[model samples]
Target: CPPIGLESHRIDDDQLLASSMLRHGLGAQRGRLNMQAGTNEDDFYDGAWCAEDDGRTHWLEGDTRRTTKFTGVITQGRDSQIHEDFVTSFYVGFSNDSQNWVMYSNGYEEMMFYGNVDKDTPVLTEFPEPVVARYIRIYPQRWNGSLCLRLEVLGCPLSSVSSYYAQQNEVTSTDNLDFRHHSYKDMRQLMKVVNEECPTITRIYNIGKSSRGLKIYAMEVSDNPGEHETGEPEFRYTAGLHGNEVLGRELLLLLLQFLCREFQAGNSRVRNLVTQTRIHIVPSLNPDGYELASQAGSELGNWALGHWTEEGYDLFENFPDLASALWAAEERKLVPHKFPNHHIPIPEHYLAEDTMVAVETRAIMAWMDKNPFVLGANLQGGEKLVSYPFDTARPLSETLAAAPRPPDYEDDHPELQETPDHAIFRWLAISYASAHLTMSETFRGGCHTQDVTDAMGIVQGAKWHPRAGSMNDFSYLHTNCLELSVYLGCDKFPHESELQQEWENNKESLLTFMEQVHRGIKGLVRDQQGEPIANATIVVGGINHNVKTAASGDYWRILNPGEYRVWARAEGYNPSVKTCSVFYDIGATQCDFVLARSNWKRIREIMAMNGNRPI
Candidate 1:
């Protein structure tokens, strides 16, 4: 069953103002409230309290639990029973105890936030930065009728404290690779400390919060921390889609720590990778589920409890159905030249206002939309193999099925739907599998007796087992990203003592997989005038799929070792073709393109100037 108010967990903006605010962890009615000298705490709710006209010092305080980290406050004026009484303007004060208080200041002056005007509509005010405080005081400076209100505090529990000792020594030390599961808060603190330790090369930011309001954090390590440089490929590794899949998440954290330490110690490979590529690692996407699973511990417990989001949705299958939309277009012959195998827009229905996509899914979709990631992989557990895209087995729509089809369709493999880049995808899968210590073993007695063994430690996702709305398929079809699903091991949540071995087994493979992003051809596309052309299409000769250059006119295409014709096409410019080859040992083949003004476009312009004369 879904939790109370789960239906209202949509985040449309920065401020949550209505009664719906309570659904987003703003629980004021349940907090301890303190009133001014002459006012009763109950008066702020039903009855109205007015400040003296002289205004010496009158306020109301809402104090949350001891460890709550305060982000902001949401306040409702008096209820309709009162005469539209409300605080018009207010100053906020923060305090750990009720004794010492500090006013929220804008450097020099104390900040004043405007409150509600009506009796029902709530108003919100956020702090400049998040403050860990138990008590927050609202001192009203102005009022409509009287300074009367109800209050709600906005924050999650302060997960862990950042200690000086940890930040200075343990954070950047490669010696202390702790082999344990980090709770959501602990993971966040670790990332924070890492960022602090390596401020120049590391960035920590949240994508979005889970249904339970825990942040989904992504840490980026690059030459330039937050900015995406020109011609640099963006690669990401995401883990913890199923909350019980704990190994991947811990491994990612270890990878983060290792990268930080190695780069600081001037490790050439780490420094080169950071300098040339933008690497983003999202350690845990399902923090709420992870919390539940971690609480239940790793000793052969019920594996299904925290496999889904707290809202009872499996995030792996929660993305919008994009594959069907693409197939429908191809079946209808709507594609003019060839089927669009890349950057397929999401279905209109999925983006509709009333759609019920999980918050985590929406956050990641938005994240992908912003980053032109060239390669990615979502790490999972419960298996020990690497799987590539098209993880669905459903038949096409009735309209699509009725159209004329090829004769080979009857003999086609329905279980596996390969992408246009199937060869490269397979190579990618094999790369990870080959690097892992035991993934390639024919039969290591399986995870359990009944467990199935994967041949060569790699397989197409749909062939393994049909599942829809998978992140790998979504990334391949809907964006410029080629993503894979790598199942780490048999146990979804291994015992804590086994973590060190698991890290040793997977560490080299993780680094090797990240290094693979630089294997393909990368270059900039520009016009004859030497101006970079944004949104230029990069098309491989035979492959129908296409990818667009990034905002910086830079593009990256991962290809297997071969010679091929590649074209760069942009509006108002003549297309340019180049032959690029990837070798077995070479890192990346540079293939830059410079397009000229289109002759046909020039003729059209001349004809228009000559009063529609034919060219």
Candidate 2:
């Protein structure tokens, strides 16, 4: 039986995720998690796995000599925390059994193994929900053979750290609201404007929702807008992962407005970018967090606290980590993660994988799966430097830093643990800094006095500061997308008055960053019938990272405009590789590949399946 709080629809049972990214490490306790409410006073049934009785039960201890845990499942009417897949609270209940026994909840999302069952009473905590007791210890004297303890195991099904609150009403009326910063309603209104005014190059849709059921909108700006332009390199610029860092969100909206106005005026630069590039902009991923942050003056006092999700989880750290995800891939006999110094901080709720990945995160992941993105930037604040992976440290005992590699390690096997595309990454990161008016200059970094002197406004991610499950690292490692962490400002939460200046500061850099997407290899992977092969993997000969084609059999890879060998591979099809030279003047080199299916193959198998320091 499934645990009470573990809802069926809430579970992420995506097989593709299970085979690759997620890959079976999470607890897969399925089918209505059996949970008995604590209102029972019946005799205890030393259940083989769990105890279920009719409201009344007792305990007759048989094995008092050997101490072990007694696992039991209990139900709650409706877990205020888990609303669909999103977890909103960490509330649970515990019994007042004078004598103690350890209890534990199987963490499906995170492995939670902390709590003393003996003296720590769940009744003392945020009570009345379901409580979990960990490290329980039932003394020998406490469990005599006739021991009839009426002590109810006010046990929680799984552990979640979110606090409970009545769901906030959805904000609809923007009558008196400030239109300066785009609120959810304001963003939707703007989305409507672009769709109607610049209908040719703009299309908008909601990718998913926030924990509080607020819609997460995505606006796609391209030449064809809705249709996939075959072989065109797609780029994405995401912002507002940290809600308090409002610069990116506001800038993205402005960019959308700018592109619409420019397209109408036939401006060359904006016309070219919108014409050639499929740019998807998600102004805010954390609408709930942003809502909390927007209340900076009223209810929420701390800006830093407002930066996190409603649950207080760092969105960047919530994705599948490089080390763990790689280990999972290797278990499936696929490629292995080269080097990772540390592990992602374990999640608070061992409840379900659903909670491990917030609803916002899941939405973004799903969006990525549908659209094949080549190069992108995650805009953020708190620092003014462009950073490149590997964000996590090297394994040389935490002593050996990146670069100045020990002579023994080869280029592919970097001792300092730089990514396979280290050269390109370095160049890309440097380009962003160089384009900026101030960031490239000295005294530009944040987070500390020393960080102010980052190497030429650009730094190797791990070298600057080690982060285990950052978005930049996850994008490069998993999807093989080239994503740079672009830190736009030092002040995390600037007032609305500063929005114009911040946009001016980042305008050129943002435009130039998207321009680089054009200098790469782009092509289509298709069957003999000229039908598109979606999700086809594109690999460059020397580079470690790879790119996958879009649903239209389209793929794009950015390079420094030079000679290269590119290979296109998909399931049940012979991989196609070709050699080509990219002209210095020509922006995107075309190198389309026509894949032939293996005799005993099904075509859809290949086509079907699909943040950050600054972000």
Candidate 3:
């Protein structure tokens, strides 16, 4: 359920006017008010001592009741004061209808008060479990001659917040409007709607909650469970882990709506994938950051609100170990020299690292652990690059490395043959570059290949560290998942026009990239009989062409096409080697092999008779 707001009423007098004036001084603007005073009155006031009129009691004669709408759960400030007079008491009231009101705070009426007209003071208030309220009012009792009251309301209005993002301006009108842009609230609404509309394949689960106590939700989309007897290989896409990088969230939402509608309409490809592969998505991993970023412009407030310490300058570089250490030793202690640190007084509250890891990263890691899917991609922005693991410089942890290499007939271990393949990763890199690069051939010149050993090392050494507990790294290293982290662009939020155009231009390519990854994974391993071979060694020559097969006889490697020899060898058989021709097919192919046994006895007799056998 969504968090609700609280409403309060105040008696108008000199003190109230003074308090309103003071609020205006503190940047609080006057809101719309409802009054019951007679029309066209110059100044509607009953002398000093006003009458306790019936309608006046609730609606206040000539008195205006202004309302402030907050989107989420509201909390008061701590420095709150009521003019020159000290606040004696304050009580919060709630009502389903504007007409009826009742005291809703715990029996303890006085939440907090101040001695002087100084800073705003926050009052402790708690909403009922699963808060769902339309109206909340606060009544403050004054200590001086006239009772002037004011209640500082906190939290955003869920209704307005949700509706504000219902319809977003697209890059172009031709793009489907049903692919609605979404915010945090829209994500929640969309999930509920999706689940209700397509119960068979749509499911909404709580991965965890954000630092601000907002539920971190995940949606799983697939065909009816039994469509594929063995829960099909899964593919995952996640977005919004960094609050400011919101385009992915919007794209994710659009994707979900698109797939759901297509599936319901019996779109063959959509149906096939949904029924054949489980697709799980975490649209917004950092809801708190999302809301803060949405409220505080993309760049300004995002880095300031979480467990971040550094102020003023951007904290984007804080994720890496070196930056974190530098920040802790220097920037963390240095307050923003330009502005007061009142907004983010505590370093932990501002840095966001502690909260981001505990809340967002943990949930994502847990989910990856359970699914162990074949393919996963984490979408981020600010770089036009696609990266793969081991993004952190760790050695490849897959069991294929330990399995036997192909009977090299030259390299050391001929007895232990049939390891998994590594070409899938290389192919994954080339295919990705082919599909997404603005300059089709440019990526080929740069660092682009899925060879974890060499490719990831260069990526890390180049300071690309999307690897710290990254969902992609977690999926690949910890499970049998082939993962990649995709950077949409090299700059922060390109112009709306450019972003829309880019997405339009790349939609087909993006889909193609996914399809290629799927196909690449499927073609990694097979036996001479064309049967899927488990634990087979598939090697491609390079700095080091080595890979082992999985229990399913599947091996994934990424590589570029050139003259390369592929060999398959097993014990009790003559090693088979072939100069295989492999290239980017833009489609699928079958690469299987067979091995013949070596006749040692016949060779021995021939060698003894001819005296030509070399021991």
Candidate 4:
């Protein structure tokens, strides 16, 4: 029940306003003096490099006697940090601790706001409503250059801050901070609480270390945590790949709590998911970024902050692009492929295929290898839609001939390379958006190309903004795992108060999305002798991805209700391909395969031809 919601502003970029500002006495303070609530990057100022909004501007015009409304205000001057030109494009906003005033669903708190797009004009912000609050907060947001500015809040006080402290105390209480952002350190403490409370269904473990050697932690939630369960499908909800995107990390921690609480309370739906599936949640994959991001929002806004990993590499970019030409040159021949039939090397320079992946990415890759995750959603921020692969089809290589590439399945255009599972991906994506309260509707503003209606709130990754070397693509292609880049919203890091609402917004969708892991084909891969195939590759036809069987000879691949041709193969064994029919709304279909040794024929003759074929 949040988003005290107020939006829209008027801008007055009149340069003559500078001399007029001397008539009013107000000099804005340098960065915040205290690390107050709502003082972080997520709440007010975002970085200039982003396509999204940025910083705050606060000003106080000459003191007013009576409660009055503000009509107009002017910019005072520029402060710290600057572009080479000493000019920048920016949108300024206002905020104050005096009263809640209004908050946007996007999570920004402000009264009236405005800014300029060029260095030439002095900024003048006019308001529709009177500045009634004794204190006026004017901050800059969504700028392309420069940092820090001095502005005037042109208004009279129609409001008072007499009860500000009391209200602040109430809002800052532990109960109101339910979905508060958790630091890497806070996560550890949370994991300890989870282990203490749900000793049986949940377990906390360290998967590996990131670049800064921060222990990348995971929360295992299942009836049998940390242990392999035969025939049970495994699902993962990975968040915080971009440390600056904090909501996913918070939601995951809450989700962990949801499972433990609901399961203990005998909630049937949760009981089933927990009992029949193994779920893993890595809260903060980039702890170093999380820390930097945390600082970016607080009074410590001067810190060198960002979403990249500690070593300065985008975590998502660090993964190996198995579809790239570099992979073809180095490891393609070694790793067999099953789909698109033609094995064309993804152009060598495609993304960072040749460069070493960041330590964090490698850790995730290793952890993924140890489990059979049928379905997953990589929680990220920056948009408010569910996106599916193939994030990219061809490399950004100069050698890439202009002739429409291999994915010419549609228009003879290479840019339209849809994944083999495009149909199913679309369905699953719609399922999430439809379940969302507002996401199903259309949004038209900054960032995306069009209002999201034709495809609903779901989008194709490459189509929206063709990115390279994404975690979703790598996981889907190499592991045969299905992962959706779930963009929670535009604010990568929102105020803590907005986090709970975010969790609620995505909760139902989250559950329904995870349930998708149970819609495809799942079973065991055993040898003719009935022995387990510890790590056999299971590839679903038409889909370029594969799911490997676990140590218990079990594998799971979730797909939308449909028929699929499944092929299971292991080292030194004859391959087995079978057809399986999956129905709508039905549970997973079980299809087991028995592979015979490639040398079984020679052995059969050596042992005096067997009387019958081994079952």
Report the lDDT tens digits of candidate 4 across residue range 1-615.
111111000111211121112111111211111111121333223221111113233222222222446565544233223331112323322335333433221345433344545432335545554434333333344343533343333443345424443233222212222466777788899888877878999888888898778898998998888787899888888888887777888888888877777777888999988888888888888888888888755212222245788888888656655545333442344434322322232335533545566777767877877776778888887567888877765543344444565654445345456766788889889888889755764633322123443548888887666667778777776665778878886556655655655666778898988788788788889988899997788878877545677789987776777788899988889999999989897488999999998986677676665555663
Least well predicted 10-residue stretch by lDDT in candidate 2? 15-24
User: How far off is residue 161 in model 2, in Å?
Assistant: 50
Lowest-sum lDDT 10-residue window in model 1 = 1-10
Alpha carbon deviation, residue 163, candidate 4 (Å): 27
The clash number for model 3 is 59
After superposition, the stretches of candidate 1 with alpha carbons farther than 4 Å from their true spots are 1-175, 336-339, 394-415, 445-454, 599-615
Find the candidate with the highest TM-score and give its number. 4
The C-alpha lDDT values of all candidates are 0.73, 0.57, 0.44, 0.61
Clash count per candidate:
0, 35, 59, 31
Candidate 1 overall Cα lDDT vs. reference?
A: 0.73
Model 2 lDDT vs. the true structure?
0.57
lDDT of 3 by residue, 151-209 (tens): 32333333432222222312353555344445677778887887887888888887776
Candidate 4, residue 395: how far the Cα is off, in Å: 4.6
- Model 3 whole-model lDDT (C-alpha atoms): 0.44
Winning model by lDDT: 1
